[model samples]
Target: MGYLEDQAAVADGLLSLYEATFDPRWLDEIRSLVGEMLTAFWDDGSGAFFDTAKDQEQLVVRPQDVTDNAIPSGTSLAVDVLLRAGMLLGEPSWTERAQRTLERLAPTAAKAPLAFGHLLTALDFHLGPVVELAVIGDPGDSQTDRLLEVVRERFLPNRVLAAGAGPGAIPLLTDRQALGGKATAYLCEHFVCQTPTQDPGELARQLDAFRAKALAS
Candidate 1:
């Protein structure tokens, strides 16, 4: 294995793959990766993740930085994926660990906004009102594509998108089904879901209302 960021990037990429293909295997892979990430990088005493894994060669100090450069810092990316994975898998501990890390870094991040760009992104997700969107349909279906398009049309950073069907699927997709045998989209926040809609237009409207409701709060 490489460093914490490498593993973080892989988990994030698997989440993206799961969203695009709705493949359960990718979800499984992500679960495994997250487990490894926690085992190797998490600092129990500090509640902050280190850039190097536990098994890496001994060094005077374990490097842990939260500033964003060419890519997100390892700490920032770790928090980002943990929050998304927690929502996707219905595992609150993952989210809790991420929250602890953010709590430690929040003061530093607040002081240097430009350097902690991705860390702030992760913080925004943790604060509240992050969107949890789950669409149930075949990846190949054109109607499914239409609904997915509406979701991807705009930039919604605080959102987790999962599209798949059947039992043993990602938690976001489990027990969800198409409305009236048509591809359906479910927009949820804090575990409460609005009416499921299959029409792209209705989906768009519901998204707007949901977003507005979140922003209003």
Candidate 2:
């Protein structure tokens, strides 16, 4: 009944939902579920998640799986979700926990990446070029729609998108505002932002340039 995989799966879904909708409510739910997952499934001594919660009825041995099977292992998926959500939601604590999880499993994953495919995928995201895009304007406006379309269509791996009218609500949009009262897109990496752009074509060029730079590095 207290399965770590089930909880992690739900958390992963919630994370995807948040990305798609940019709804703060989904982020709140993710935070709550992640907190509960840590409290219930985390092994303090090993710093990895157990297959079952501590309070569950004990078998001969509690399983702690790190290898990826047909699907990503629960621990791997949990780490993936945690890292992404942490970055998007500005939760240092969640990111820290995810880092610890990766550190704990790094040795094994390094030696046998094939056995930990999902974990390696997660690690790639951690090490890869991650872009955070913020779009600001009236959500219902045509300009805002065009900007959002450019963002959603672009093929950037390990990307996070946040769109809204103003800055007061979403943390990612804290200081972001429209340029000249027109819908604008801001592309950032490692917390450094580029000049905000209103034209979709300009945004696309900037994104391509950013990816090129990332690849070069």
Candidate 3:
């Protein structure tokens, strides 16, 4: 149990860093590791994963439930890893694997959404467009710090966070060069970005509005 959780922790850490760095290598590494784990842990005929490894002689039943509980399930993590790899790397196989995982869990999700939060999160990622927020500045700077905080607090789904300084305004990317002395926020949903904003309050409101519009549609 500890070993599996540790592997998941490594995957999660890699994912968090990949969001900021946008490095393709991280995506590849995650996919490879996740794929290996899935291959070893999954029950090929049942379309489920055993909570315990196959080598273990002590397990009585193979657990396939995708419950969120206090921690994510092995199957849920596989789905998440596949979904992110596909989205970030534009790999069709990864997307297909994620879809398969979701399809296997659909009945479980329909029975109880809360218990399947992680599964639903993966589903949400696939169903709705993912937004990306890029903020570039010192984490300690007041304005930049506030902007980062507001962005993080927003409950928007399927979003990626990145950091760096950049040129003029662009789509799926922010032009933060204007905030010469402070931090900036670049919000991009479905590959279209709003103009860079320096005011944290304004950014929060814009995010609220955007989320409202998104949920309504």
Q: What is the lDDT of every predicted structure here?
A: 0.86, 0.83, 0.68
Rate residue 138 of model 2 by lDDT.
Answer: 70
Candidate 2 lDDT, 1-217, residue by residue in tens? 4788899999999977866666668877988898899899987677678889878998999898778989888899888888887888788877777788898889988888889998887887888689888988876789988988887787776787777786644577888888888999999987789989999999988988988887897
**Better candidate number, 1 or 2, judged by lDDT:** 1
Count of clashes, each model? 0, 0, 0
Candidate 1 stretches greater than 4 Å from native: none
Better of 2 and 3 by TM-score: 2
Against the true structure, candidate 3 reaches a TM-score of: 0.66
User: In model 1, where is the ten-residue run with the lowest total lDDT?
Assistant: 164-173
Listed in order, each prediction's TM-score against the native is 0.94, 0.92, 0.66
After superposing candidate 3 on the true structure, give the runs of residues whose Cα lies further than 4 Å from its correct spot: 1-6, 13-70, 84-93, 112-115, 138-143, 166-182
lDDT per residue as tens, model 1, 20-133: 787788988998999999999998899989999999997998798768988998888999999988987889999999999888888887787899998887888888788888
Local lDDT at 111 for model 3: 88
Rank by lDDT (best first): 1, 2, 3
- Candidate 1, residue 166: Cα displacement in angstroms equals 1.6
Q: Worst lDDT window (10 residues) for model 2? A: 163-172
Q: Which candidate is the best by TM-score?
A: 1
